[model samples]
Target: MNSFLSNAKRSCGEFLSSFKISQSTILHMVLGNNSCDLDSCVSAIVLAWFRSQMKNGNEVYVPVVNIERKQFRTRTEIAYLLDHLNIDSRNIICIDEANVRELSNVGKGFFHLTLVDHHVLLKSIEYLQTYVKEIIDHRPQLIELPSRIKCNISLVGSCSTLVAEEMLKNKAFSVPSVVETLLLATILIDTSNLSVDVGKSTPRDEAVVKQLSGKRTKDELNLLFRSVADAKFSVSGLTTEEIILKDPKWIENSLETIMMSTLHLDVREFFAREDSIDVIRNYCATHNLLAWVALAPVINQFKPIALYCEDDEVREKIIEKLIVSDLLLVKTSDEDHARSDVKFLRMYNCKNTRKQVLPLINEVLQQRSSNLSA
Candidate 1:
C-alpha cells in the first residue's frame, strides 16, 4: 500500500484503540454509501487518505465502509482489489465496528461527514444528516441540502472519477501509481471498461482513464477489468446467506422494505441450494422484507428474476404489478415451487437494471402499504 494510505490506516487503528463517547477527539470521516460497492469503497478510502495527507488542521481522518464488518469479506471485488493493493482490510473501519452511533449521539458537532458515491443518507444513519459536511456523487441531486454543506453531484460513470478529479486538481499526481491504478480500475468497472456498448462511460471517465493509465497498455487494463468483473460475480466461498447479502440492495420506504440481491450464477443453481428457502426467510424476517428480488444473470447473457414472498396475497399483488410493467416478467417454475411458502417468478429482462426494477417494486410496496392503512 502507499505510504499515505498506510498512515491513514494506522490513524484509523489508533483512533479505534481509544474510541469512546467521552473522548475529546473529533473525527472527520469519509463514509461510503450503505450499499458499499467497489466505487463507494474506493472513493471513501482514497479520498480520506488524500485529506489526511493534506493535513488541513488538527483533524483526524478516517474512511468508513458503510456496512457490517462481516459484510466486508462478502464483497468479493472490494476484498480482492484491496488485497491486490496490499491494504489490510482489518485496518479499515466498517460501520458495525465503528463508534459512529455513539459519536453521533454525542452531538452533530462531534464529527464531520463527507458522503461519497451517494448523496442521500440511509434511514438508519439519517440521524447524522446535520453533520454531513460534503458530498461527492455521480447520481443526480435527489434533495436539497443545507447551504453549509458542499454538494458536488453530477452525471458520471463513477464517483471515483470525481475523486480522481479532486486528486488531480490538488496535485494528487503525487499519489502513488497503485492508488491511481486503483481509481482507474473503479472507473473501468463502473463504466464497463469505457465500453461504448455499455454506454455508462462519460467523457469525463474516459479522460480520467487516459490520464491515469499512462504506459499501461489497453490490453492490460482490459485484462484487469475482466479479472475484477469476474471476481465480482464469483460466489465461490460464500454461503447461501452471504450470497444473498453480497451485493444486496435494501429498498426502504415509509412502510415497507424489500431486498434485491444480484447474483452472477445461474438462477437454477441458487434455487438448487439446500437451504435457499430457509435463508430467504431468515433474511426477510430480519428486514420485514415484503418481497425478495432474486436477480441472477445467467451466463452473462440472460437475466432471470425471481420474486419471493411468503404471503400468497402479497406475492400475487407484487406479481400483478411486475407482470404489467415494462419488465416483461414471465413467471417460470423450473423447480417444484408449487409447495413452497415463498413464491418464485422467472423474468428474462436483461436491459432493465435495478435502476428500473427497484422503483417499480417500491411502487407496489408503497401502494400496498397505502391500501393497508386505508
Candidate 2:
C-alpha cells in the first residue's frame, strides 16, 4: 500500500471509530457530491486531509458521497486514478457504510458536515441538513444555510482548484508529489487542458498548475490528462445503464424524479446503439424515472447532439417548451427512434452545456405546471 493511502485509511478508520464512542462528541464528515465525478471526489479527499491537519484533535472523515464500495467500479476513471496512486477502494469509506439515521439519533451538535463540490444538498441526504458545517464549491451559489459556516464558491474550472489554492495559501503541510499529480489531473481533464475553446477554465487553473509543478511543462500535464481521459471515456465493459448511471446528477421536483446524464463518449455512436436505448428505457421504467436528459461533448465536428426522454404527455410538453425557448436547440434535425422514448437533436449552439440547458428545461417544466394550475 502507498504511504499516503495507508495514512488516509488509518485516519478514516480512526475518525469513524471516534464517532461511535459518544453522543457528546462533534464528528465532522467532509463529503463530496452525489455525482462522484473526478473533481468532486478529489476535492473531498484533499480538502478533508487539509482540514483534518488543521483541526488537530477533531474527528474528520471524508466519505465518498452517494456511492457504495462496489459502485466504485462504475466510475472507471476514479478507479483508474486511485489505482494509479496505489489507493485501495476497500480502504475508503462509502456513504452507505455509515448509518446516517444513526448519526441523527446521536443528538444535536454531535454530527457536523462539510460539503465539497456541491453547494446544495440532495433530497435523499436531507437528514444531514442540520449537521452541515461548511461548503466549498465551484458552481454558482444556490442556497444559503443558516449556520455560520465558511463558504468558498468560485467560478473555476474545477472545485479542486479552489481546494488546492487553500492548501497553498494556508502553508498547510507540504503536499506530496503524488497528491500534487492527483490534483493536477482533475483540473486538466475538467478544463480540457485549459483549452480556451471549451471556456470552462480560467487563468487561476493554469497558475495553480504552474505553482504545483514548478519545473514541469505543459506537455506533462497534457500527457497526464490524456491518460485520465482515456480511462474516463473507456466503455468497453460498461453496459448502457452503467454508462448512464456513471456521473449522473439526480434532480427531484414536486412532480417527479429526473436524471441528467453527462457523457464523454461520441454522441453519434451512443445513439446508433439500439441496445443503449433499451437499457435507458428499462432503467427508467424500473426506477420510476420521469425523465432522462443526455448531454455529450461535441462530437462529429461542430455537430453537438442532445438527447431527452419524452415518452408521455408531460415529458412531451417539457420538450416542446424547451425547443421553443432555447435558441441553441435546433429542432430542424431530430430523430425519435421507433419504440424508444429517447429523441436526439442537434444543438446549433455548442456552447450551451448541460449546466445552461438544465435551467431551460426546468423553466419549461415550471411554466407548464403553472398553466395547468391556472
Candidate 3:
C-alpha cells in the first residue's frame, strides 16, 4: 500500500478502536448539497472524521439530497478520499427515495447511523427521535432530537470546521495538508474571506485559514478570496432574478425581492458621484416595486446602513415625518449581497428591520393576491 493510504488505514483503525463501536454497524450519512457555507463545512469535517475510523471491510454510505444539486461537491470530495484509500466507490449510495418509508427499509444489521444536514425533516425527525444514533448540524431545530442521539449544532461558519476541531481534540488524526487547505478554502469562500459584513469570522475559522495558508499576508488571502469568488455564477450568464434565488437566505422565504446597484469609484470620486441613492430611486420608479431598500457597508464601523423607501406615499411621509434633508425615491430591482451581505444580515438582525418596511411588503403581497383572485 502507498504511504498515504497506509497512514489513512491506520488512522481509521485507531479511531474505531478508540470509539469502542463495532465496525460492522457504524454507517455514516454524509449530508450532501448544503447551500450555506456552514453546512458544507460541517459536512466535510464530519466525513473526514468518519474516514479515519472506517476499516477496510466497513461500509460507508453517502446520500445526496435530490433537491440540492449544488451540494455535489461534497460527495465528489468524499468519493475522491475513498478512492485514495483504495476503497471502492460502489459503496457510496445516492439516496433518491423521497420518503422515510423507503429510507428505513434500505438495509438491516448492526448499524449506527450518523446524519449531518440543514433541512428541516419533520418525518425524519420523528423517525430519528425513535432510532437515530447521532446527528451533527447547524440547524436550531435539531436540538429537539432525543438525547440518546448525539447532536451538535452551532451558528458558526461551517460544520466541517467544527468537526475538524473535534477530531483534533480527540487526537483522532492530524489533518492532512491537502484536507487542511480544502477546509480553509471552503471557509474563506463561504465567509467572503472574513469580510466584517458577514458575522465576525470565528477564531476557529481564522486559525484554520492561517494554518492552511502558512502565512498571514494580504496577497495570499486575496488570492484565495479571488479563487472562491470565481466559483460564483458569472454575472453575464445569469439574470438578476436567478442570482437572487441562489442566495441561501432566499431559499428560506424570508425575502420577497432584492434590489441592488453597483458603483465604481476612484480615490477622487465623491459620495455625490456615487449616486447610489438616486440609482435606487430610478429602479423603484421603473419597476413599480415597493419595500425597496439599499445597503452600503461602512467598513470602519462594520455595519450596513440600510436605506429603504416606505411606500411612495410613505417614503414621502417618512421624509416629511423625519424631516430628513437627504431622501431619495426608487423602484425595486432584484440583486443580492455578495458574501458580506450574508454575514451582515445575520449579525445585525437585518431581517427584523422589515418591521418598519413590512407595510410595503404586505401591500405588495395583498396586491398580488387581489390580482390572482381577479
Candidate 4:
C-alpha cells in the first residue's frame, strides 16, 4: 500500500468507527462540492488528512461529493490523478456508497461538516447547512453561513491553495511523495500553472506552488501542466452524454435549471463527431433542463466557443447576455457547429469560464421567472 494512502485509510477507519456508536458519535465529514472537480477532490482528501494528523481522536471522512463508484470513469482527469498517485478509490467513501438520507437522519447536529472548494450549499444537500463547521473556498462569498463556522473564503484560483496553506501551517508536510505530487499537480491544473494572462491565479497560489514545488522549475511545471491537460482532454471512447457529464456545471433557482458542459476539446472537433447534438439533446430532455450550454476552446488557436440549445427565445436571451460579458470576443458562425437544436458562437479572446457564465445564466433565469410572475 502507498504510505500516504494507507495513512489516509487509517483515518477513515477511525472516522467510520465513530459512526458505529450512536451514543457519542462525533463524525467530522469533509465534503468537496457537488461538481467534484479536481480541485474539490484534492482539497477534500488533503484537508481531511491534515485534520486526522491533528489527533483530535474524532472521526474524519472525506466524501467525494456526487461522483458514485459507477460514474467514476466519467471523471477521467480525476481518475488519472488518483491512479497516478497510487490512491485507491475502494478505500474512500463516496456519496452514493454512503446513505446520505440516513446520514442526515442521524441528526444534522451530530455531524460536523467542513466544506472545501464551494461556498454556497448545493440545493440537493442544503439541509446539511446546519452541520457546517467550516468553509474553505475560492469562489465569492455568496451565502451567509453561520457565524460560528470557520470560513476561509477567498478569490484564489484554486481552493487547493488554501488547503496547502493549512497543511503548511499545521506542519503536516511530512506526507508521502505521491501526496505531495498530487497537491502540486492540482494547483497547477487549476491555475494553469499560474499563468498571468489567464488571471485566475493569485500570488498566494504561486507562493503555495513554490513552497510545494521541490526540484521543479516553472518551465518543468509547465511540462507537467501539458501532461495533465492531455489527461484532462482525453475523451476518445466516451459517449456524447458521458462527455457532457465530464465537466458539467448546473445553475438552478426556484424557477429553472440550466445544465452547461465545458469541454477541453476544440469546438470544431467536438461537433465533427456525428452524434454530439443528438446525445446533448437526449441529456437535456432526460434532465428536463431549460437550457444547455457548451463551452470549448478552438483547436490550436485556443479561441473560445460557446454553444447552446433550448427554446429559441431563451437561447437568444442567453446569447445577448454573453455578448455583453465584456470578454472582447467576437461572434462567428459555423453551420457545422450547429444542428436543428444547437447554435455555436465563436469567441476571439477566451478568458471567460463557467464561473463567470453561471451568474449570467442565473440572471436570465431570474428575469424570465420574474416576467412570468408579473
Report the backbone clash tally of model 3: 16
Select the stronger candidate by TM-score from 2 and 3. Answer: 2
lDDT tens digits, residues 277-318, model 1? 888888889877777887777533555677778778877877
TM-score of 4: 0.90
Worst 10 residues of 4 by lDDT: 1-10
Please report, as a residue range, the 10-residue window in candidate 1 with the lowest summed lDDT. 330-339
Residues 1-374, candidate 2, lDDT per residue (tens digit)? Answer: 24434555555455445667743345567788888888888887777667766775546455545576666777888889988987776766577765666766665566678889887776677878777778888877655667677788898889989999998896646887877988999999888888888778898998888888866787887788999999998887887777887878876655566778887577767767778777877788888877787777775544344545655776666556656755565553444432345566666667566666666666655565577577
RMSD of each: 3.2, 2.9, 11.6, 2.8
> What are the per-residue Cα lDDT tens digits for candidate 4 across 110-192?
66788998867657777877788889999877657778989999898899999888777756346556667778889988887
Q: For this target, which candidate reaches the highest TM-score against the unseen true structure? A: 4
* Runs in model 4 lying further than 4 Å from the true structure: 1-22, 171-175, 217-220, 299-304, 328-332, 372-374
Predicted structure 1: lDDT: 0.79
Higher-lDDT candidate of 1 and 4: 1
TM-score, candidate 3, is 0.49
Order the candidates by TM-score, highest first: 4, 2, 1, 3
- lDDT for model 2: 0.72
The Cα local distance difference test for each model comes to 0.79, 0.72, 0.42, 0.74
List, residue by residue over 1-374, the lDDT tens digit for candidate 3. 23333343333334334435543444444443323233353353446345546546564433333233333333333333444445443322233322334334434342335566453343223353333555666434522555676777665655556655565564646565555555665567556687775554677766656655655477866775665455442233333333322322211112233343211111112123334345445655665544343233223332242335544553444323222221222222222432211111111333222212333433444444566567
Those runs of model 1 whose alpha carbons end farther than 4 Å from true positions after fitting are: 1-25, 140-144, 299-301, 327-349, 368-374
